[model samples]
Target: MESENVDMNIIPPQIAGGAMDAVEKRFFETEAEAKTFFENTSKRLLSVNEWGKYAGMSSFQLMDAHGIRADRTAEPGDFIRIDIPGPGTHAGMGYDWVRVKEIKELSNHEEQISYIIVQPCSHPMDKDGAIAHFFKDDATSTFIIRKFGLVVSAEEHGRNEIPNTDHGKFLDKSRNFVVGMAAKVGLSYPQWKNLVKGLLQN
Candidate 1:
């Protein structure tokens, strides 16, 4: 399919419905611009799963189809990022890392796995400081609003690049596209930078 052209300068109506308004004030000159961008983005048919691939998890579904379990997938201390309260709401649209504290198999649901997670209260305002329980299937699948996946790092930037391929240019374009959509929803470029800095530091 041909990619839809979007105007990054306009904000969509959806921004007013979320936590993005907080940061939108800092980056966008006016709310109207943010609205225009978001309205255009809404016309695009990108699903949450396709968008989540950029955050990592490009091959999770394939791996799952082959019957791989969490024991062979993720390990403790590995950062698993998830979106709480999901999309199309006033909830914040940010991926917060919850490190795996423990991994256990479910007796009730065969082959299903769960992870005990500890969210780092890196910031003073973080209220989800307590350990939380997350299911591996819930985290990987995007049949619902929330999708948890592996965290992509700057270190893995060119690991999949083919020799002589202009992968960096394509990656930059992809990054800019997502950033544009994120900014419309209130995760301005500055806020995203801050969020990534926190992720890398922690």
Candidate 2:
């Protein structure tokens, strides 16, 4: 079997610089098995809600997540709704929303790669509402699945930007401060790591 590197050019600099980065990989005995697993795993990666099942085994679980497709096609305009349990929920701040910015696929005789990239965005239901988004638009989360020879890898790559809003100039300093502090203290890495593990689980 031939060995080749998964393309890293798909990752933008902003996401590459993200504060939280996590990755996980699984190896298969045969390239055919790896290809089969890649197809199933890619679907799971795109179905954001199913993440809970895989991450549930970890102490830090992804409690709630949903994907809102723009159309039946499941393209770039879709949205992901994520609820992070904490003060934000207690205060009725609402869930975090990220827009699907890109869905890319690349392939050759020896390899196949697929990824979805999302960036923080205003809540789709209430764009002008008072709900404070936890991350700035500059922040991104990329979910990737790559098949190379007899190995498969799943990756989550993105940067966390300070919390801000796209709807208005009103900034929630208190909430942003808390989230910023959490990001700095490395509160999100474990969750992301578990999420990546969930992606590669058998």
Candidate 3:
């Protein structure tokens, strides 16, 4: 199929009964554009393009079938990175996931930003069986919200991974996104509770 931005027109079931005003998560690649969008968030919601990615697969399963083997493989500290097939239900529309190794608070442009260096488990198992490691520690694959097969004994599974491939930006911008959106509109985003009480129409 010809790849293009997912048309917001195709509404997901979650919004079938008006459960959500919209499920579109705007992402921008650059901070300036993201900020500009936020400045006028109230006028209309425009998703910023943070990053462009694809598992280079037809769908999530294509990547899995090619070379995805996270089953029982690494530890919390053991370095690991694998392309897990996104269920494509939520977590925005994207094709790739970032496997974070560790997070550090560093100063950039005099601003404190949380940065992570992850081994892109894209198929780089070293002699020691590590995808990518720029750190001193060998145990990485298991930490954070990474997806691991049964080999590592990770959580059942996660809907979203930390440091999303297209997750984009640092903490400052992230916090700003929330605060900015709120400032744009007098109301805050809907709370997750709606799903529990069935308050959401859908």
Best by TM-score: 2
Q: What is the lDDT of residue 105 in candidate 3?
A: 27
Cα deviation of 120, candidate 2, in Å: 0.6
Candidate 2 positional error at 106, Å? 1.2
Off by over 4 Å in 2: 1-8, 15-18, 57-74, 89-93, 128-132, 165-171
Model 2, 24-59: lDDT tens per residue? 889899878998999988877776657656655322
Cα misplacement distance, residue 62 of candidate 3 (Å): 20
Q: Which of candidates 2 and 3 is the stronger one according to lDDT?
A: 2
Q: Residues 50-121, candidate 3: write the lDDT tens digits.
A: 111211222211122233443332222232332222222122122222343433322223222222233334
> What are the per-model C-alpha RMSD values against the true structure?
21.1, 5.4, 21.5
Q: If ranked by TM-score, best first, what sequence of candidates would result?
A: 2, 1, 3
Poorest lDDT segment (10 consecutive residues) of candidate 2: 57-66
Misplaced by over 4 Å in model 1 are 1-51, 54-72, 81-95, 108-118, 121-202
Q: What is the TM-score of each candidate against the true structure?
A: 0.19, 0.76, 0.19
Of the pair 1 and 3, which is ahead by lDDT? 1
Ranked by TM-score, the better of candidates 1 and 2 is 2
- TM-score (C-alpha) between model 2 and the true structure: 0.76
